[model samples]
Target: MSAPDTNTETQHPAHKTPLAGIAIGVGVAVALLIALMVWLAYNGNEPRDASDGAAAVQIETPTGGSLTITGTASD
Candidate 1:
């Protein structure tokens, strides 16, 4: 009896994974987050000057006690 011939050609092509694209996207996101964090860190530590037009409020309670608060109006 004769042996059957085996097929040497592939039926389907191999599909490539988008590893490089995913890596680049992750890198960009991380860089943007780091930059935002750095910007916030620098801006948040700035000192507020008293000459910057700060406002104060005082409230008198029914028992003749007073509450004093001071800061900018936006605070």
Candidate 2:
């Protein structure tokens, strides 16, 4: 009695893991968050709705002879 030969050229599907997909998703989310923070920080430095102003005041000193002081005693 003769036995039939089995085929040895059949291909099997490659195995895949879920860790790679999860890592890529997390990386994208982190990159977007960092970009948003940088944009907000740059735009937050602009000045708005305010104006600059200044003011001045006058000063004076006494000029009377009776108000003057001397180091010598007066007789």
Candidate 3:
């Protein structure tokens, strides 16, 4: 018996795993989501022009009467 073969080298498969692809796709998706959130946060906070519509505030008196103060956007 020729000295029992002692080769210990590990051989990797030629085909690549899908994990890398999956990770890349997930990263891109997360990046897009972050960008969208940032865009919404930025755009959502913009000041609105009073000319767009009327603004009203309502207050209730202790006597059960309600008073509404209304003003045009130009105010």
Candidate 4:
């Protein structure tokens, strides 16, 4: 017989590369990104409410000695 052809058709199935590795790498990256976004959403909600209802002054009141009380109230 003459020399056989050496084209792509002569390649073996065992020599072929797999597509599974590329798909798994992409799937893992997407899962991590979604988890990080959820954490940031819960963190920003609390500080906004605390700043709106803050107090500037505290007072001390004494009992029936109701004879003397001195202070100025301001708004």
In terms of lDDT, the best-performing candidate is: 3
TM-score of each: 0.43, 0.40, 0.43, 0.38
Q: Please give the ranking of all candidate structures by lDDT, highest first, separated by commas.
A: 3, 1, 4, 2
lDDT for 37 (candidate 2): 100
Question: Candidate 1 residues 1-75, lDDT tens each?
Answer: 764753435422222246666888999999999999999988895456656677667899999999988887667
Record all residue pairs in model 4 with backbone atoms less than 3 Å apart, i.e. clashing: none
TM-score of predicted structure 3: 0.43
lDDT of 2 at 35: 100
RMSD of each: 10.5, 22.1, 9.0, 14.0
Task: Give the higher-TM-score candidate: 1 or 4.
Answer: 1
Residue lDDT tens for model 3, 1-75: 665754545323322457677889999999999999999988894347545466777999999999998887467
Where in model 1 is the C-alpha error above 4 Å? 1-17, 45-75
Give the distance in Å from residue 32's predicted Cα in candidate 1 to where it truly belongs: 0.3
Report lDDT (Cα) of residue 65, candidate 2: 29
